[model samples]
Target: MNNPVMEQSTPRNVSRRGLITGTGSLLGSAALGGRALAATPRHGRAAAPGAAPRDASIADGAQVPALVIGSGYGGCVAALRLAEAGVDVQLVEMGMAWDTPGADGEIFANTTDPDQRSYWLRTRTKQPISNFLGFPIDRDIARYTGILDAEDFSGITVYQGRGVGGGSLVNGGMAVTPRRENFGAILPTVNSAEMYGTYYPRANTALGVAAIDPDWFETTECYQYARVGRRHAQRSGFPFVFVPDVYDWAYMKQEAAGAVPKSALAGEILYGNNHGKKSLQKTYLPRIRATGKVTVSPLHKVTTVRPASGGGYTVTLEQLDTGGATTATKEVTADRVFFAAGSVGTSKLLVALRASGALPRLNEEIGKGWGDNGNVMCGRANHLWDPTGSLQSSIPTAGIDNWAAGGAFAEVAPLPTGIETFASFYLSITRNPHRAEFSWNSGAGRVELNWQTAWKRESIDMAKSIFDKINAKEGTIYRTDLFGTYKIWGDHLTYHPLGGAVLGKATDNYGRLHGHPGLYVIDGALIPGNTSVNPFVTITALAERNIEKIIATDL
Candidate 1:
């Protein structure tokens, strides 16, 4: 059975709507025109007008126009724009493409399996790996893993994807735009309308962002999840709202017809959504590749970036799976390089590269101003109606903006599904913690993130009051400060990790390394502050905005 939704057009379908508005044919014609822009063989003759040149076939250390280290949303967008601008772009991803594993056998790239804990960073104990979410954290080399369990939780949990799509591969696939005030708080100089009004919609359109239709609630397990939210709201006397998820319904419908489950069924994600969910491996990269100039080499972890004597950068990369038979490494040169490996990877790389004197001339601000967006959480409700035989996997689709009312931190978003019966995610974009410090932990062979979170009297009061309001409503609700409980559960769960390589008057607004002209940080690390809401849309907007600047320079 085919997905009836996908096979047809709907008003909610932006492209279909665009067609009705006359823009559909325009986009269609543009795509039709782009066909001639396909990739040309390395040794072949010059390509047609829009054709992207092939860089993979080139010899070792090939010189390209742009080099993007991580193939996540940021890298993919940068590659596409640069390539379409006629720049030769090479996109390298640390994780390989996802391969569905068999029941008896295991596949290295499929972390979606129940047995793998590769998605969350966890403390390995004799007792199953326990984090705030209380889920097992498997650090398997297989399943194209990401850095799930960050050693430090005061900052953010910092979930990173290793495969072709980076965080997009394992993220909740929730595309949310930060509130106007939150966005302004971080990048004060940014014009709200320019980003939110214009760019935000464009980003959503390009990514095919849409809310899960009400039918998803009426016809599937989504309703069950909503019921859990409603019951909690009713019992606690707090309001509950539906959250929009980026999980493609059309695709999920198809997967269901084939007997594949959907994330709505308590399908534990964050480890990886085996059930059809929004993993970037299936989203942005393909169209970006279609621009013809972008080529992604999965399982290629970037090791270093050195400025070439004359121009551009020399990027070093290594294959992820040689069975560790040998750590074969390679390097290539590019006129421009974008680091989209998220905060942990990008900050670590920059800090290491600078500290090792690879780019000794980097400014003092190279690895300074690190923050985890001051995340805090307090959940209260007057209900204990935990639904059985259902998965509460999706987090908050809607949130309140009390943070603006002189409340605690920034804002609070709901935590959806979990191993336990009663748990909700509460994210705070409160007072930006005095930036965390970053250093290489040679003994651990990883970056060490250290920060001291101070409780602002007002923020704490606000947090407590927010819960108080809910408690006054109906039933019993509990308050848990994620950071306060860090000693026990190790920094409650946070999918959003930000800062490290911050942007401001200090660093170039576009996140270019202060003194290093060709180096740019396009990942979450570049975000100067955090938002109370999910940070994906904000990250995407910043990336999109930055790439536009990079291309305007034609470097």
Candidate 2:
């Protein structure tokens, strides 16, 4: 455990020296267990060797037991676990380090003067909305080709994060352990005692997840919002549950020190919590790095992975910055690698690699069975209610778990993005279609997601039922008809996307691509089907479970 003094003294700033070495394993392997060892700082920086005159432009091979791609939830979890197990693990993140590159690592913050504009985008565009969301992709189309039109962009709910922490760095930070049943659904093969009792606790603690502060529950915007629904449920009681969140209690304490009086409560979390929120970058990865065996290399984009001569993997990478000049291309070798670059990232990379004949032995299920978990936005009303000026700081502190009763499950959370307060409920109900297809378009360099519409009536019927109940109640001045009014009958925008590379009776439950032994797929791509709820926690827990199995077999 890290002492408070050490935690406090650790600088939040990013060091340009790039990689730091320390002595401690990720997994709890006794083989390398010892006092944490810190490597002496190398004062002079070395320009990437690939940039110089080299026959083949690849980074000199540095051997490690495990190499994790993408520092998102799954990759971070895998890196931490393997490092603790005495494995020499290296983590490569495509995104740049946070804070310096501004929000999404797209621009620099200090480039614009304080008198003019603090960020580059503010000066570059006429409207804030247009510059931020409107620009389509010219360069780096793989990640940033604005898919949504102006009107649809406003209506279209999309989420993407690029930084040391990945999506967890900029998400709403609401953390809820999946209902034990939902957690069990994916792990039909794994036993309950091991799955729920052990790994669940480990993940929760690692995440520093907790129920919303009881005081906040009473005073926060959530209470006022919940009151609208409670009045309706009073007539015919339907239990609503308060879900847990990943908001950082300590960061909240620190912000309280400066005391800024804003209408919002917990700093508009959806647009990136500038104050205090429990993002993965701020939470787990730091702790994982403290173990010393793991080194995180940011601004590193992995393009290809090939089976090496010694029965390991040789990963081809590109250094985004070397002496202010980007390198040609670099490669590194690792005994094992975990691909946890979220659903879209993993699927695209795998599909492209297979198309390139880099890893042809990858399972036939490379890009198949992709579903977005039928998402709907519905709201309730309380008579005589006027919450116009009330602070809608916290995002999604309350929810109804009634979708399970109607073949699907719906989880509702507050949407406080200054978009619309009337939308008291942003609900996503699960839709289990028999099959869906995923295909990658190389010309466009994007993955196309298509889902067969089944259980359509059930989906609308469920949304209408929830909406009607809320409106019927008194003292509520608003109504929700996101489905009927919005014409979002087809595919609704969802924050949670699952199933591009799916798990099944065919592939290993742990997501080791069917025929490929050492290559693994441990992100959202492995969910057997729609999780019927937010699948981030499920993804993290499943990764933890999978890493445990990997250790049992490999270590």
Candidate 3:
């Protein structure tokens, strides 16, 4: 879901490929000249053996049967299915391939020690948790195209992954599916029976979703923090559930046993996991490549999609360099286009296109029903006796489920600061009803979100329904040092940005755009806001269902 931070002003007419090449040269020259030495690898992990195969960039004036706008979950699914049906597909990603190692020799940077690879084209890192123990934790880094993108709107910062695999590369790997009873609310137009009976199982199997070894979880040193969280949840009468994840539990066990290089146990979930976690690069992209009918172009951004002079759609693209500069501009024609560039990316592009008259027939619901999935972060200060572990696993395996009773489900997140902080961290997904909209601001020449930060108050209140009671029962207070000076709620950012292009209103039941025959929205933008849990599994399953239908009938 290549979501780059929106620039306030209109972009310069520079080539994206030139910028990337210049940036890469700058980094390479610095490393060779000894001005920028790569940091030593941590956690006993070795450097990446070598670079992986590169995806060919798209040429100007090329024509394709299908153009998938993103390499995220939905785009990958669409490309694979379309290719399997003997259709030639071209997938364009706005970020780097991430197949090559950096100056550090590792494919990704560590969470504790962020480098240039930590953020997307930012001079500094904007960590989700900005503070720790009353001190700011952000640091400066070289400006190159990185993995995570903290895209800022008016009132909120939407965090998205910037590389080929999209959000899967930077996420916590919590592949959660909503409870069957709650499925109706998540996607009311979709058939729940088909989803639960077929698509859900299919998605889960493809994603390698699995539960933790409960017996080992009870006694593992790395999961001691989770155990402490469970004890507090049980004492407070909240249901503590073991959340399944996409991480390879077997590799994690090997990490714990010191038999393999540590990843999850070494706090490696934020930037990108070098091992253990099964990101889309390891899962879907490999299969998509195997089909040989789908060609992917990383660092290629789709800028416009208009009706071609002759037939099909004319797709304009900008080839970006590592430094986020445009090195080349290419125009291609596609018989069909699938918008899967995440919620923010897809919504911004659609709103701009509609307002600019490129796609004038696009419906009025283009940029409506955007949500943050009610994301809020807080920490609980525990007594010294209940130390929440010095060593913690970066992969979250448990959560406090109060969704039905309190409208909040909090994952017992890890605070892997390499020391015992005597605090328990939680990222709660509450049932926040406030949905923002993305609109084309003619004055600014950019898409703006009409989201007031105050809207998060509802989310805060819902989250309080769970933590406030826990605080009362456990006699613990909310930790104010993690967010800011005396600030308890980390409400400024959201990892799960859902909606903007809703299913029924913005698109048909099968994700076909209402007014456009060949355009489709097949990503998180299809889900209207909250999913009552992590949304990736739902997104994948929904895509599975939609693409299957499209292939059977439309294609």
Candidate 4:
């Protein structure tokens, strides 16, 4: 999706052009008469124009034209498009604003030195790489609302971002569009031509997706690890490809030149990127605020949704404190509601709502077709001669593409330990066919996913197809100290959780709930698990297509 013209343009130029030309009809009408609002304050700190009010909160008996649950990619898209259509929207998020800096003068904590700003409501941090150098690296932390949520189930741990921007707040910013050939498998019901020709490019342009300068990447000290990874993959006869990211490339260049404060160069992913990365807070949320038809309330958790006595849906929400305590309960009515609380959150809510007699007409597919996006991690112990650098960039630039041949695309991830580990780390997304289901457990009164850890075996094998060959070619072995003692595969967790309330089965072609006229599922829950690569770009594009149709037809 990288245009040569866009690659050569600076971020400032790109932003200006995108606002004027890329959004086109989507923002053109709204930009003319929309009242600009302040951006959603980060952790209560005031932000610039194009943000929601700092004290924005839904009143107990509020009534809105549209209510969007969760402020992630899909929710943001739905909110923006609906607002552009001149509808008033109230967006409720379960996480903090993250606009204010902490005592350490940073809005987000570093990955290596985490504090209360790391894990969500956990007394101890749950690092994806739980150990390093044969020792557990997990540490105790205050129980506060943090960025990443390492939600543990019976067999696997799902790491999710908890905040207004959703997964965009804590991801590696690898904005990838699936191959056109593979799009059929990704979303079989959708028209690939429209997606590729219009929505994908639209999403890419609005997302500020850009490729790194190839010449600079080849020589930057920060990307030495990626270069080494490329060498190993190419030497082993695997295809190495550069992936586009939402990060500000010009700012990254300045970071490399020591002209600005380092973010990607400093160990700053996993938790969140303080600078450079163009998360939803910088992209979609600002646009939503610019529409001036939306009010976003952070730290508000939706608990129940039922048909109102008069009409529409009556939604119950619990306002939460930083320590995960509910301080107030409120009710609001909306003519229409969009479920955009991610895959797991959306599925869990829908399942519970269906089973709890709130929305009994929901189909049986409410809790079905859930799958981890074939996420698996591993590290290779390189020879001492090829020591991975200590000063590594947190942003991943390249991946070993074995998807067509081996059903896996391995991101040459960074250790970013700030020390020479002589290890090459990777996060592989593979074609694992196993799909799990989320069911409501009445006795436990919670949503449960029957995702066994054994399901990851296919993913591990697929990833090994690339790494094993590289290891054989380079005379190396799998690193055993990263995940746990003697463990070679980090298969117990997934960063990309998809499906559950799938597109065709759970909703109509445009995300309208099958039984409910005004309810929709627009988040990752619509996808059936795998996307053949990173899933965010596809998610955004799909939401874009779905909302456009809904605005034209429904609204």
> lDDT (CA) for every model shown?
0.54, 0.53, 0.83, 0.85
What digit string (tens of lDDT, one per residue) describes model 2 on residues 369-388? 65555565444322224342
Clash count per candidate: 25, 17, 11, 7
lDDT of 1 by residue, 1-555 (tens): 011112112223323222232222223222212222112112233322222222343235788877888877777777777877887777876654544333332222122233323432232211111322222323222321333434344434454565566676566666777667666777776677789877788777776677766665555543454455455444543444455567766766554455564453434454455545555554566567677777667557778888888788887777655222225678788887788887777878888888777877766665666655555555432233443212333433444445555344323332332223343435444554456667767787766766544423333455544555544443333422222321212233345667778877335877677777888888788776465566777787878888888779745
lDDT of 3: 0.83
Q: Can you rank all candidates by lDDT, best first?
A: 4, 3, 1, 2
RMSD to the hidden true structure, all candidates:
14.0, 15.2, 10.2, 12.0
TM-scores of all predicted structures: 0.74, 0.73, 0.91, 0.92
Report the error of model 1 at residue 368, Å: 2.3
Per-residue error for 474 in candidate 4, Å, reads 0.4
Superposed model 4: Cα runs more than 4 Å off: 1-44, 48-52
Runs off by more than 4 Å, candidate 1: 1-59, 100-113, 116-157, 215-221, 225-243, 250-260, 322-326, 377-396, 406-432, 440-447, 453-462, 477-493
Candidate 2 residue runs with Cα over 4 Å from true position: 1-61, 101-158, 220-222, 233-236, 249-266, 321-327, 379-389, 407-412, 415-423, 442-446, 452-458, 473-491
Superior candidate under TM-score, 1 versus 3: 3
Tens-digit lDDT track of model 4 for 336-450: 9999999999999999999999999999899888888999998776766786686789999889999999899999999776666667889999999999999989999999999
Q: How do the candidates rank by TM-score, highest first?
A: 4, 3, 1, 2
1 or 4: which has the higher lDDT? Answer: 4
1 or 2, greater by TM-score:
1
Better of 2 and 3 by lDDT: 3
Report the poorest 10 consecutive residues by lDDT, candidate 2: 17-26
lDDT of 2: 0.53
- The alpha-carbon deviation from the true structure for residue 387 of candidate 2, after best TM-score superposition, in angstroms, is 2.8
